[model samples]
Target chain A: MTAQPDQRITISVDAMGGDKGPATVISGMAKSAEKNPELGYILHGPEDELREMIARRRGGQMLLDRISFRDARDVVTMEDKPSHVVRHGKGTSMWSTLESVRLGEAHGAVSCGNTGALMALSMMRLRKLPGVTRPAIAILWPSRNPQGFNVMLDVGADVRADATDLLQFALMGASYARNGLDLPRPRIGLLNVGTEEHKGRSELKKAHEMIESFADRANFEFVGFVEGGDIPGNRTDVIITDGFTGNVAIKTGEGTASLIGDLLREAFRYSPLSRIASVLALTSLKRLQKRIDPRRVNGGVFLGLNGTVVKSHGGADDTGVSAAIKLAFQLAKSDFSEKLAARVASTVELAQDEVHFASATQEKQEGS
Target chain B: MTAQPDQRITISVDAMGGDKGPATVISGMAKSAEKNPELGYILHGPEDELREMIARRRGGQMLLDRISFRDARDVVTMEDKPSHVVRHGKGTSMWSTLESVRLGEAHGAVSCGNTGALMALSMMRLRKLPGVTRPAIAILWPSRNPQGFNVMLDVGADVRADATDLLQFALMGASYARNGLDLPRPRIGLLNVGTEEHKGRSELKKAHEMIESFADRANFEFVGFVEGGDIPGNRTDVIITDGFTGNVAIKTGEGTASLIGDLLREAFRYSPLSRIASVLALTSLKRLQKRIDPRRVNGGVFLGLNGTVVKSHGGADDTGVSAAIKLAFQLAKSDFSEKLAARVASTVELAQDEVHFASATQEKQEGS
Candidate 1:
């Protein structure tokens, strides 16, 4: 469909979501709007404060035309209980953003607020897409392929998951790969300790069997099991796992990048001669650093929700906030949610039929 | 406690470990010996190949009194099954190295071979330390702390674990911190989904209660739950988790470092002007990189073992091998096994008695 003259994809951004808060979130949205003409935004926070930020950015005209305001008197602190905050603190920018999605006023909601709160409220308010029991937070991870951006799901939504949840995550992650990244037949792998068909925890094995049963009809290529190290190896385009494992992996990866950056700094400071040699090698070093900067891949889209929920890093700065807004716009414009809902509904139908067939076959075998 | 004239600690080194095996292992040992006089080594591999490498370094006669040799016929490939290769290939360098530890010729074995094999062989040969149902490989992670390393255990040994295993890991890790890092009283934390005591998988809650039960003993500080991000936060000295989680975290960290290094290289390749800015910032970046290089902190001591079992990174170079050897020496001279065995044995005794007393008290209450 061509762009609707008046029906813009209005995104509600949690202005007080990250470490940088309203200032950086507003700045990022302003920068993002400079490049995308069709994107519109609604700043969800204290109205006066958000307006001040917009005025400072010289975005008064855009604010008047495309941007509006949603006043949230309360802000969710990092330590606030997710359930309580989402329940009692209805005025929080995070809750307000999700409210916009629920009210059909925005195409998506983006926030760098308390992760647990965003997840809790999004699931509580927007509800999961039909046939998806648990919605996953999907992030594009650094991969070995030069152009690779491997999609990983369930980063921190549902910690204790079953085989069915894993399969749902796979379907959702595949939809993201197809609809968000615009790829055909994204290679999907079940994240496990080993690649063998029989390897991995019992839940993973059951999930594997379910995925295998639907191999013919599933949207993505089932590439079997993948190990922890393979996430960065870029061997598969989409990786599926429970939220607990994915969250740990993502945080570990971030911590490691910070550690390596620290190490490189120490290596270059060995001696005056060594420092000079490092300076000479700066051209090559910077080439590598920019390719894997966390800032470039800072947002995780909460998939399978009725509307999009974008999660920026808890430690996001202005640059990262900008990237998150751009990411949210891309997801909104791509209209991946509708496509994801359809794909999930079809997959669940196929999985249920397989379950029924298996039971029937077992009964027949017993009768014989 | 002075070096007993006859109480020597011989550690077997795998000459054929990693991509650069014999050359790097040999050079690393040479470098290690130059720094530690009390350390002795028994390099195992093909006689001709090892001698050729040793000759290139110094033509022999240097540290000959401190080092010896053992010959093995084959090498373990990365893809080899730990169980089959360890059981069937006794004459291989990997097995021979473990054999030295088993035969009491060495206090510990250091290998950059497949980690799975080393962990399997160590358990099968030396047996688990008293009350340690399963052994864990503990890595001394480079921290932002100026003091030294953060100890993380079960770095890919046990895939599935119970609360009991976590308790055992915490005790073993505490021993390492107290003896290895010389922490008088180590701060211990359970790696969980969140810092909240109840915010993790069911097993985490049980583990938390168990750790708290021992808080009165005052052997170590029970810092309760720590999230995955806490590993790099430098908040606790010892972080304990199951092998699957630890392994994934460690590998994710390594892969992230590699990815960041790649990104930095790309940032500098944009243009000459950018290259100059990279040069100006090169010193700080180099310092950061060296602070987290896997080579500098390569050796991960497999704790909860009758004897020291140092599991080197499979992709370790010479520097890594040397670091493993050095760690082996420190572990050996420190008489870690005796301390570890005593602590485990005592902990088990305490736990058993506590259980028995609790059951008896419950019976009396029921009778009343």
Candidate 2:
């Protein structure tokens, strides 16, 4: 788990979990292998099928040498309930993928399966970190920041989060940003309906005070409250909210992006002159697409767990899967999971002290 | 306030409430006057300033003939708290604007003011409809629907909504879509984090059942639960949620759109060839911009109230203000408030009956 330059970082892959099947997964692995020499893989699925798919690739022999296979008989479908999967998914590729991480055979796990099921199995196998009540799913959003992305957490890990849970998210999110994005001191903002002190639900106001109280000790700057508009804006490095709001916000962002993309395509096909202009502007447009492409920011890292798990998009192609792999490699290289755990553990103690202090202050006030 | 072909529709204007000065409001009124000969305005602000601005327009004399002035010396700034404004804001233009509607002097009102203040002032002045506990702010989102937009409600009206409040929102939203958008039977969907039955908060689950129970009687098709993406998607015509989630989703959508637009402009300005292409694509690009322009969908109608109030964006310029005026005119002409009141009143009785029946059923089960 040490970040030694010469240490090999192996990623556990659930090859059969994706919509595009194992070929795309194998191709993504090959792409990752071509870029990094210190990377290895533990491909989880039916061993023979994965072996044949890897052997048929362009640099099949080299890829075969770096990849080891684990035979898993079952494939977790998108429709399978997370609870059902947890009880009966022991033989699945997703389970085996997390098992590799749990057994210390791989540094991290990547799965392009049902998100709910993946999180369920992940929690079942890896368990929650000490004092982590709700594990968060953090994703990188394309932003106008210097790092070119902002991290948002609890994007559908659990539908609810209390004041203390939100404080935990702020600490964990700051840690992820620091290690994963190379920011030494990240600015964290609690997401609310308005930036005003009196707005939003009462939990947000309580969480705001809790997060601010621990900001200095946690090595992150508290930017106070931010709105949904600031999620992709350059105002903050880490945006923290309960899973319900974060999930809706990110999906709404994606839906808006997709709608605009569709509209742009329709505009280009409006006339022959516009079509010609599209051809002329193809390179610039491609550059723009590359900059804002969801594929480039593919992984949703599951934080506050014993091990790291990167949930790739269910419909991800090779390019998308490769992006997830790159993220997993970066996180593993930085030992992000361990760092996040340590950050959360220390903050939990701080949070408890603050709670006790607050009640004691109230008691003194009452006595007076 | 019956819809009559020859009756002139007057919209009360809060001239000093917007980020821009009274000049922008006067210009917007002039634009509306130019388009519709039957539209009149009760301009609320310092009388002399509004008069001078109107007189300075191109068709000064003609415009002045249809406009009336209300002298309110104070202005409500964005920083003003809603509670403070409601208690001490009698002399403000925002209060005067709603006063016109309350006194039946104007058919509807439009203000580009602080949203919280507007809604608070509105509830206090106009009052809520019978059996309506929480009034909602419904806005039109640019979408793929045949009508070109979707209606989402409770977009920061209040921070919270219980199951019954959500049911009222569903009924009110359906009425807005039917009368405002000219849809006879609209489709209503409750917004949640996911489309699954057991995915969101317990209140959402309760709201789902309550909403479904009244769909047929309310004259709208219940599309069940919808995610954040469906806010702008074609699956539903009206999206209903608590103010907190709806507020975040819309702002997130707007932020994502703004980010893509800035990136697109940067791409087009990248090189000389791209600049040439931008020139050629000007018409098409403008067409695209016009299609999704936020100004075109500028008004957020405060539903579940006795009178209709359209809250324009605080930063709205002349075009945006004009759009708000246009919506106010449409709703006034259609007697949208009357129709919505009728819809909610009947649904309220039905809801009471359902409650009684449910209790009766439980009694019968206990007896058995």
Candidate 3:
């Protein structure tokens, strides 16, 4: 269904599993609904507890009126393993949450529970798209681009991905930039150790050529290769790498940013004069903090799945939860799930044939 | 060559190849000499240029008395590839500089040239240590530990490393920590995507058991597996991974740190109030900047080679060049080369055996 400005969009929320419980989740939903009045939500939890909470609403009845309920007997705790969740999670809030998407009762699902569990449940219920080998976790990283962020994929979907998988990531990431970031001609880059013609593992080289071959029909410009140095910059709109490399890169960037932010605070408070300066510069500092805050960039979109599922950070409060909900809303409003499915299904065979032929020829040359 | 306090030590310097030319390299050496007067130098470059530059150095005849010139007709530029350098780099300053260490004319060598070129020349001229299939490039990362830094290796020596290579990195990194950082027993960690017991790829699991078995004889504690979040923190003294992961981690950390640093500066200059605050906080900001400056941590040590070589940044200025020199002198003074060779020679075979045995047992179990 196409998004009409006046038409209401329904979203599914797993309210029982977040760190701050339903209090923060409901508050975040109210804040989001204040700006997006067209939002209707399917709240997943024990209906009795949620009813009491909704009855005690601080805001007017507008937000309360938009919410509906689905009863899930159990909650998926943070300690639950992905395998365990998949095996025995039929009645749980997390499973019930994604079931809404599968049943077409909601456009998408959002959760602030364990990442592995969410991905498992989503993949099991929603299923992988046709021709998709491994689903990827894509997030928008703050960048020097005019759009203020860039797409990096397979952050922690799985630990390993082959050359073909990386090629799929490049295609999916390009589609993400086009639909999510609204870039007309998104540039794709394969992450490697160096930008030179001859560097990194054989898979990266293979993926480089694979991505280059498919750029024209895929409707994205392939910019050869980029290093980790390019991840936070504006040089490329999309970066595709294995889950291991991408995961480590994301955590490393976040760790370094947190360390620098801590040091900056300490430095600004070093002396009385500096303390006064800090007070004067508080607004500017807060602006920078808001711009780079991980809390503001909460959702990790599960790409290549039949239905979109956003995993919010486990410790996310109201603001983080709201940011994640916003991502889910935009994706749902744009009919992103259908667009992504069409993009992958239409182009998969062509990309696969190219890779198979390239590898076969490479094997022949090596044998000779 | 034990570290006797009063003994004079020699350090070889390639006074070419840096972006700023010989002026910054020489100035850095002079600064190091002022702090450590017993540092004798064998400066390599065109004799005419060196003689003119050294004569102009202040503090007069005393510093000059300790300096000697090694005439070289050429310089290895930043654009020079490693293969090209190995073939046509005989007379270049970078080649001549490392040759001095090979011939035992100097204890250690330092160059602010191309990293790929320097590693190529050093490996070719100096050779790998016994039992070492690969040599790693180790760098001192600023950390939350009281020692203020940690060791991470194989930054970019090669794009790939196997289980056996990772074992060697752990040993060599431990030695560098012991000799370079003065840690009696450095804690070594295997870098992976997760800290869970049964996460990440098979090689990581194999390496984990391998490192554990060698800890007693290697004389360093193994911290099992660590994620990228621990890179800047005090979790482990040495983080071991393949060159691709290590290189990306370093670059991603640097990129993120730099982006935050740039944002911090802009925050302090946003308005008139913040501008005044910037003036008042200038000294503190400078202190913080110096604390995390990449120039201050300029050298990446080439470990598991017969002799020590430090790769200063190609874009390093006076201060960066000096930091690299000081590291070389310290390694030389401690006889780091001999210690490293002994460490690798003694420990590599045992770790290799452990990996093979573990894989065999696992395969047998699977068949059963």
Number of the predicted model whose lDDT against the real structure is largest: 2
lDDT of 3 by residue, B1-368 (tens): 34457778888999999898988888888888888877988889997877777787677456668777799988988777889999999999999899888888887889988888898888888888879888999998877778878899889999888887888899999999999999999999999987876888888898898888889999999999998888888899999999999999898888888778778788877888878877887887898888789888889999988888998987788889889989999898888888887788767666568689999999999999
* Each candidate's fnat: 0.51, 0.81, 0.75
Give the top-scoring candidate (DockQ). Answer: 2
Give lDDT tens digits, candidate 2, residues A1-368.
44567889999999987899989988888898899999999999999888887788788999999998999989999888999999999899999999999999999999999999999989989999999888999999988888889999989999999998998899899999999888999999999989988988999999999899888999999999999999889999999999999999999899999999999989999999999999998998899899989999999999989988999999999999999999999999988888888888887787789789999999999999
In candidate 1 chain A, where is summed lDDT lowest over 10 consecutive residues?
Answer: A1-10
Clashes (backbone N, CA, C under 3 Å), per candidate, total: 48, 0, 0
lDDT by residue (B1-368, candidate 1, tens digit) is: 12245576677887885776677777778888888766788878998877766766673558555677888988887677777885787888888887887777887788888777777877887788768788888998876654567899878787877899988888888999988889988889888878876487999899899887886673999999987776776778899888878877877777766766666667666677657656666666656655666788888888887788887777777677778888888778888878888889999999889899999999999999
lDDT of 3 by residue, A272-331 (tens): 888887888788789899989998888999999988799988888989989999999999
Which candidate would rank higher by DockQ, 2 or 3?
Answer: 2
Which ten contiguous residues of candidate 2 chain B have the minimum total lDDT? B1-10
Give me the overall lDDT of model 3: 0.87
Q: Residue B51 in candidate 3 has what lDDT? A: 76
- Order of all candidates by lDDT, from best down to worst? 2, 3, 1
